[model samples]
Target: MYDVETRQRALALVAQGRSLNSVSKQTGISRAAIRSWQARPTPRLRRLAPCARCRPAPGAPDPADSYAYVLGLYLGDGCITRPPQHRTASLRITLDDAWPGVQQEAAAALRAVFPDNAIGWARKVGCHDLKVYSKHLTCLFPQHGPGKKHERPIALEAWQQTIVTAHPWEFIRGLIHSDGSRITNWTEKMSGGQRKRYEYPRYFFTNSSADIIALFTDALDRVGVEWKSAHQSRVARNISVSRKASVALMDLHVGPKH
Candidate 1:
């Protein structure tokens, strides 16, 4: 049997665009063997690379903080689509046009995790979609599946949970960037026979998925940020962080999504 390292070396050579004949001459492996290795399943070949989710003793992705942040963004507003005819799949995250900084950060985060993947930008009606094409996006984000994220179950893998534990703020920031918001509300008060305006700043995270909401709030709880549940409408539920201390904490880490 060919050793694992031998197969990996042959596959890596083929990935580098070397012809099977040349790779065989260089590695002394037969062309048929190299072709068979190349024909192995996607995840089989993907295991040769470092993947926190797929590796035998998987660790956090390098730049695990960035991965945590992007994980939030993915849960909030990202989707992965793989075409039957295409070998590579696409990971896309939607960001509003108003927040250029958040868009740039999302793009940078995607690049940070997938350094070898090509990143692109596509414009939509009111937002821009950051597009990244990779063979390993599924390995990175195992939560990807059919249907709307809110319509299906979403849960973090153990390695992802580890990353979030290490970088809760970045995760919260990403969630806020995608579906949460920081807004100011004002009220009129009569004090000392005069009318005064009191303003309140709070953070709101809305998601249709209760599991996703729980994940956000669980992360908040871990960071000692207090939050409460509120229904903005009949169908929309929001996890609101309005406590003075909680807002302060969120402001320090997440702030406005500008």
Candidate 2:
């Protein structure tokens, strides 16, 4: 009799794209046990009776409960963007520019949602551009004001959609520039003859025009827009400027502003 909870965990790992071997290594269960669990149908236990090695301890936590907690964490804090990669970028929001009550309200809301979380502030040693970086429970939130210099705001949803619509060519060109760079070094000297050095290339551009085109096309398709490949090719090359083309592009770029 295999532990039902263990079987559920194995299934979850498989769903998360882990190889069977990786799952076995992670769970400390044999590959054969994983296979048997996978093969057995739900609501139908195997004919063979209790296997002593496979039995779970009394009061063991249910895998379903664990999975639900993990799902909640993901839904609450996980980034939905594809590839699950991180890029540091600058976010500039002045105390005056944004709504007056937004910051305090947002902070209070976050605390209410994540009771265990803490927030702190720190300043960089020599950097004049960056004023303070906020530390949340598990993530670093960088805040920028008038004087701070940070990465370009490439990931903001509004900016991303703008690049997809109004400035696709510039977006594609920026990606090309990112792909053609070489590695660089960063080193600094500390007090008392101690020095620290780290090798990290400056931000690399992703020459991802094809990716952008695919994304935009998929978005248009979902909205039932009748887009033509020839039009896209011409726009990519900066040659599509007929009146009809202009109207079509305008329609795509700015939908009914209701």
Candidate 3:
């Protein structure tokens, strides 16, 4: 086992872009040994359970239960709207029609797709007659105009079915775009004191397109996706290159072969 001081020094050298071999030479540790140490998992802090008196007893009402209940409502027949401030409370009264059950089925499908997310639901009411909004409607035709006041009730069940049938890939592919957005979020700091963070290493992959393809291919393989690559035209317009000769190569024709 390496001492804490030695590990810290080795990590510092690695962070400074020092090669593993160079670090091993300076620290008198084998490169393989250093690599093994780096691979070891660090201890994590565990949260202690609250005292019996402070904790909610089994079967007792919990805040999470309320949220879950609201989620059920939303999943069933709830809607979103800007209610008037004067309204005391809005009750989501489902009509005797079969729409509520249909909505529930749709919600079940959505739950199957994203089992980890805690989707919530609620209905809105106000002094002014208003429109209702549902996730089902938005997920289907994302280009639909914004919710308007004095609109009739939307067919939540039909909308949800349309969404699932039309864009099954939308759920998964949307995550890729979201990952890029998350990276942007990490690189750009907010006005508040929150620290910018990244989920992956900045230099984990190489700069070349081929390297990127290799990295993604490896990732796809891990995910059990079959993929094939083919070379395409390298279209370049206004890109800055450090070397003029490298820029000239971009003008040359590259055959379509990968």
Count of residue pairs whose backbone atoms collide, per candidate = 0, 4, 0
lDDT of 1 by residue, 119-164 (tens): 8999999999999888778888888888988788889888788889
Where is the poorest 10-residue window by lDDT in model 3? 176-185
RMSD of 2: 23.9
lDDT of 2 by residue, 1-258 (tens): 558777888878987989889999998888888876777545333343232223463221122222222212222122222122423222111222122232343234333333332422222342111111112211222112232112222122342343335444322222222121223546786757887665533212222244333443444444434444432342231111223443344344432111
Q: Give the better candidate number (1 or 2) by TM-score.
A: 1
TM-score for all predictions?
Answer: 0.79, 0.19, 0.19
What is the TM-score ranking, best to worst?
1, 3, 2
Q: Candidate 1, which ten residues in sequence have the lowest lDDT sum? A: 40-49
TM-score of 1: 0.79
Clashes of 2: 4
